[model samples]
Target chain A: MAEIAWREALNQALAEEMERDANVFLMGEEVARYDGAYKVSQGLLAKFGSARVVDTPISELGFAGLGVGAALVGLRPVIEMMTWNFAVLAMDQIVHNAAKVRQMSGGQLRCPIVFRGPNGAGGRLAAQHSQSLEANYAHFPGLKVVAPSTPADAKGLLKASIRDDNPIVFLEAELLYGVKGEVPPGELLLPLGQASLKREGSDCTLITWSRMYYHAEEAARQLEAEGIHVDLLDLRTLKPLDEAAILTSVRKTNRAVIVEEGWSFCGVGAQLVDLIQSQAFDDLDAPVQRVTGLDVNRSYAAVLEHAAEVNPARIVAAVKQVLYREEG
Target chain B: MAPAYPKDLVLRFFRSMYLIRRFEERAAQAYGQGKINGFCHLYIGQEAVAVGVNEAVQPRDYLITAYRDHGYALARGADVGMVMAELFGRGTGYSKGKGGSMHIYDIEHNVLGGYGIVGGQIPLAAGTAFAARYRNDDRITVCYFGDAAANQGSFHETLNMAAKWSLPVIFLCENNRYGMGTAMTRVSAVAKVARRAVAYDMRAESVDGHDVLKVYETVKDCAAWCRSGKGPVLLEADTYRYRGHSMSDAATYRSKEEVEAERKSDPIPRLRAWAVSAQLATEAEFDALEAEVKATVDEAVKFADASPEPPVEELWTDHLVEPGERDVPPRERVRGVKVDWPRYPSGQELRVKWDLEPRIPVQDGEPHLKKPA
Candidate 1:
């Protein structure tokens, strides 16, 4: 196993995948020469050459649709949106074209493409740049949505996403780029639609994903110290959701708390809550609680931004409330 | 410089345009009769553009267009019966009735699609060219769109990328005067759609769309330029649509006089007149061709009318290639991560292919439509 930053893990996956298949290429703004805006594509251009590691002008819709078109004709293109916030500009291509092509073409054609980049709040980037769009993308049926919380998960899930024959929206946490973790050495690919049991306990189940997984884990540790054992589940993939894992955990703990970086209204956490209620309702000892980003758009002010986000404290509070340790 | 076309080739161009005109006329009539439904955009007056471009390129070359694409499909040699069956939403259709009039696709002819959204296929055209260049193939992709689509942001963006990459793509803009009900003058900042290509440093040309020969020559040159790895080219075919944008359109925006003036340059009649006057074919020969085209369209309508609707079980199929059936396997498998296998909803069985025999009982309440002995 090698210890690397989350960004390096993603870079390694891209490099390895490009090396594995000649048809695989990377394209986006700053992916070439600039080494990516967040440097996730660092050293790719020099290694793969300009033809494979393309630097595109800042036209998201054009490039994204181009990537879909390339995928249609047997090229595996990994498109890096400078950030998922900017992906909103290319939503039509992502939503209408990439997601619908395989089915629309009746299996005659498939878009084997990946749209990846940092998602969720990056400190005080404010409203436009700090929104969490996983739920919006997950709402589309044909798309596979993966949010990797760790360096290991990032490398594994990204490789799987690139190899998968469907369009994927791989959401990476901008804040977690510098965070270091041990990734399993070569060829470690994680499947989509699976949840990981980060920490095992029995009192309450804390479900989260991406950057929020860390908060849920921290909250689980804090709850353990307080004599309230919690089961932490990191839902790696949102769209073909790990229903079995979620239901098993909820059935065991008999209580649940979902934490997410996106807003509470119609967020991924809301979906989790619905799943637990519908599938594990008879096993629940208490109402499923949620700790999510405030419903309003992200604010530029540091204090307001901090307050708007869900942290370990919020997760812990929600867990305690679900476990009946605190009043609603 | 235009190449001197052979007499037979000129006659063939008239036939191709006439076929599209008649096919679309029948499609519009079917829409009125409720035999076909949903967002049917006719290629009534712009038949010359599709036929000319299709005639300019090889069968291996790719073609993509906007929602106004029945003419392109027919000109590219899609089976007339199958195309009409698709409009009828039948199991025998090209897309198995899943894609309606705006989403016609035929992999056999290399017709990428009839994309529903405005300017959606522009980037896709560039991508197909990128694929051709990547594979070191000589195939060129021709993308057809309306005049108003030239004003879309993707059009400029795709043109720039195609030029920068030197992709083998021809951006054909059929400037039909109106996008839906809005006039080109009202929607586009520039009067000439081809002039927008200047911003990308790509070659652009405008041709008289009513003259099939001019369109054919321009596209032939453009295709050659693209295949030589020079770069993408933009060709604007100045045309006009005789019908409204779609079946539901009232065409309240234009005057009767303007419509009449544009109709005087109707491409099918113009081509037929030129074919006869230029001694490319005799007037009697043109008359025989028209009769042949009418018969072909009538047969297509008959086939569509007799075709059955797609089965109810098809709703759950073709979403994605199932696991273990994908062209490539997942990068690696992780323990504890559940691989969700697609399951058919209750009462629906996974059918590899549709049994197209007549399902409803006939006179004797037994299977009626059987394969010939």
Candidate 2:
């Protein structure tokens, strides 16, 4: 295993996939010559050359639809949105064309394409650019949504997503781009929808993914030092959720807390709470608790921004609430 | 150049045009009987555009169109029985009755799909061309849309990107006067859709869509241009629809006299007149052709009627390609773009040799220089 940043892990997966399949190509705004907006696609243009690593104009709908068209004709196109926020402009193509193409064609065609980009809040970037858009896309049936937490998982799940024969919304976080972890030197293919139990205990269950996973990791460390052991489960894929893993952890711990960096109203965490309450109601010791980003437009100030999204403190508090730990 | 086109090809054009004409007529009748429910847009007057382009396009090439796709599907050689069955929402339909009239697609015919969204296929068409460029495959794509769709942001976005990449595709607009109830002049800043090509650094061509020979020859020449490593081309076929936009449209927007006047230049009769004048066939042969088309249309109706409703299990199926079939490099005929434009009496220069006259008054004060006189 070698220590690598999240961006480098994602870059390796893209470069390897392109090398494996001649049909796979990458295109997006500044993806080629600009080395990607976040530098995740750095050095790809030089390695793959121009034809395979293309730079598209800032026409999200056009290039997104273009990716769908290329996929329809047997080419595997990985379209990079500068950020998941801009993907809203291409929602018509995603919802109407990408998600519906396979079923609409009566299975005559395969839309083997992936729309990958940075998602969720970062720095002082307000409102438009700081949204977690997984739930919006995951609502559609035809699309498979994946949001990996660690560097190794990002690399492995990305490879699996590229090789899969369906449209996938691969969400990556800007905050995790520079985060470093040990990634396997050889090939790593993590199957989609398989949740990883980062930590196991008997007191409570902490379920999270993507940016929120980092916060949950810290919360688990804080709780472990104070002798409050909890099960930390990272859901790698969102749409085809790991229900068994979630149910098993909730049954064993008898308490559950969901931490997510999204608004609470009809959010992924809300959905998880519903699933746990309905499926594992008899096994629970107390009602499930949630730690979600405040439903606001997101503030530009550092203090307000930190308070708006999730933090380790919030996750720890939610865990205590679920476990009925009333005092310090 | 030769004196005239082959008699077989010309007659086949008439057969295709006449077949589409009758197919839509029966589709309209089926709609009245409630056999075909939902938004059914008939291709009554734009037969020359689809027949002309479909005849000119090769098997390796592709065709995608808007909701008004019954005729183009026929022109691209999709099974009439299947297309009719799709309209009737039967099990035997091309899309397993999952996709209705607005969304018929077939891989065998190289027909991408009949999209329901206005101007939605414009960007998608460019993407298909992008695939060809990526694979170094020479298959050029032809995308069809209406005048109303030209006003969409995607039309601008797609054209600019396609031209920037020099993608091999043709964006053909059928200017059928009204977009739903709104006229093109009322909505678009520039009613001449072909003129929009100039902003994208691409060439444009406007042809008399009532003339099948003109449309067929022009598309062939345009395909040749795309194959020679050029950017996308925007071709405008000035035509009209005799029917309302869809089954629900009352068509109270246009005057009855305007429709009656446009009917005088109906593509079916006009092509028959031109083909007969050029001595491609006799009147008796055309009459026989008409009788044959009527029988074919009747058979398609019977086939659609007899087809069973899709099974309950069908709803759960076709959501994704089989897992085993995923990620395999595409099965493609790597043969690069082969130009099918034959060296014969065809295209604009060939027009002088034939003594055919226009049936409708050709419009003047054109927006583009390539506008047919």
Candidate 3:
């Protein structure tokens, strides 16, 4: 095991996978000579050479579609979007080609490609740059969506994603790149669709993933100080959500609070709420509370931007409301 | 210069073009008879482009095109029976009835697909070429799109990337003059589609699409240029589609005189006249070849008509590779055992277990780091 940043863990995973499989290559805008927009792919070009780590022109739809075509053949391509925000231009390839090829071709083709990059808000980037689009991607059936909060999970989940024989939309949090954690040495492939329990409690359950998991953890600490302990669940993968872990936590606490960095309406939290109410309805003592980003375009001002988003304070308040300590 | 193709090869080109013309006519008839359903775009007048290009490239080379693709598929050697079965929405189709006229894919023949979206295949062609280069292979990818597709954002983006990476791809624009009903003059600032290639510093040319030999020679040279690592080239074939955009189109945008003028240059009769004039084959030989192609089309139609529709059980399949493992079927109630909390060791504990010093100690109440203000 070794301590590394989340970005380093992702880089390590790419280097290791590229080294393992000759067919596995990386392509995207600035992934090679530029060493990745956020430097998640730093040193890969030097380590793997240009053929394996390719730099492409600023053509999201083009390169993304190209990656799908390559995947249709026998190549395992890791396509890096500068950010998930820029990936909007390539939604047709992602939604129509990569996602539907296997089914449309009746198992004749399998697009084993991974489209990864930093996702969700990063400071006051604002509007186009700060959108959290995990739900929109997870809404599609053929895609495997995974967002890891820690460096270990980032390395493990990415390795698994690269190996999985399906199109995966791996959403990495920009804000969590510098966050440090211990990653296991050698090949450590974490299973997708399994939720991790960050903390143990019975008063209330906090469900979140990716960057929001940190906020939910902090909220758990605050609730513990107030003599009301809560369970913190990190939903590592969104599409094949760890529903058993969620129901387990909600059933034990009889109260739940969901946190997300995306907009309130039709967000991942909304789907969680539906799952909880439908599955754990008999065990609930109070209505599930959701803390999500305000439904508006992200602001340019730092203060307004912070106010419009989900944070530890919001998670704490939502947990308190679910526990009946604060009014809804 | 005249193409130096052999007598047999020239006859084959004529036969290929006629096959496409007759296949498309039958397809349109099938649509009218309610045998084939959904958006069917006939390649009536543009048979030479598909046949000429396919003949120029080797079998190992890749080909992709837009929705008006029965000609491209037939030209690329996709089985006529399977292609017709796909149009009939039968289980024996190339895509097993899931993809109709718009999405015919044949992996074995290296025909990537007949994409529905205009210009959608451009980027995919670039990527396929990138794969060939990555694998150190010598195969080139040929992409075909209509004139209207040249104005799409993907066309510009793909051309830039293909040139930048020096990928082995040939971008062929079938300039059918109209994007559905909209005239090319109204949509494009530049008159010629090949002129757009200069923006990417790539070599480009325009050719007479109705002339099979011209298209064959141009595509042959361009495909060779790409395969020899000269980078991507754009070739705009000035072709025309005699039929409407889709079966639903009334085609009131153009006058009858314009249609008549285009018909004067119909590729099939032109090829037959050339073959006879050049002494490649006599009128009797041309008639015999036409009869042979007609019989082939008839056999394909019979095969497709006899093929069964995909079973209802097939509807739930193919949407995913491992459906059972991924899809959690809906249940009446919440199932599965409750997972215990603290499922794994904490990050701090892991650091100690792995004998590594903590980079950033885990602490409570510390504000998360935000990007520089």
Measured against the true structure, the TM-scores of the candidates, in listed sequence, are 0.91, 0.93, 0.90
Model 1's CAPRI class?
acceptable
lDDT of 1 by residue, B1-373 (tens): 1556687888788888888889988998999899999899999998889988989999888898988878898998778887888888887677777887988877657788888889988999988888777766788999999988888889988998887778889899898888888888986678688777777767777899888888888899889878876778888889988889998997989999999999998988887776666666889988998899999999999988898888888787667666766421111110122333222111122111211111212235422222111
Model 3 C-alpha lDDT per residue in residues B1-373, reported as the tens digit of each score: 2655688888889889999999999999999999999999999999999999988999888888888888888987778888888899987787778888888877657777888878888888987887777666789999999999999999998988777677789899999999999999997898588888878777787889999998899899888878877678888899998989999898999998999999999998998898888887899988999999999999889988998998889788766556334322111001232321111122122211111111223235622121111
Local accuracy of candidate 3 as per-residue lDDT tens digits, A1-328 = 6799998999999988887777788888888888888898899887877677877777789889989988877678899999999999999999988998777655566788999998999987989999999999989978999988999999999998988878999999989999999987878899988999989999999899999999888878877888988888999999789999999999999999988899989998999999999999999999999999999999999988988999888888878777768633
Give the runs in model 1 whose Cα sits over 4 Å from its true position. Answer: B1-4, B324-373
Candidate 2 achieves a global lDDT of: 0.85
What's the C-alpha lDDT at position B257 in model 1?
A: 95
lDDT, candidate 3, at A205? 91
- lDDT at A8, model 2: 97
Candidate closest to the true structure, highest TM-score: 2
Tens-place lDDT per residue, model 2, B1-373, is 1337888988999999999999999999999999999999999999999999988878888788888988888988777888898899987787777898898886767888989889888888998887776656678999999999998888989998877777878899999989999999998788988888878767699988888888999999889877765667899999999999999998999999999999999988987888777777999999999999999999999999998988999888766665685321111111122322212121122111111111112235623224333
Query: Under CAPRI classification, how is model 2 graded?
Result: acceptable
* C-alpha lDDT score of every prediction, in listed order: 0.83, 0.85, 0.84
Q: Which ten residues in a row have the lowest lDDT in candidate 3 chain B?
A: B350-359
Report the poorest 10 consecutive residues by lDDT, candidate 1 chain B: B327-336
Candidates 2 and 3, the one with greater DockQ: 2
Question: Which one is best on lDDT?
Answer: 2
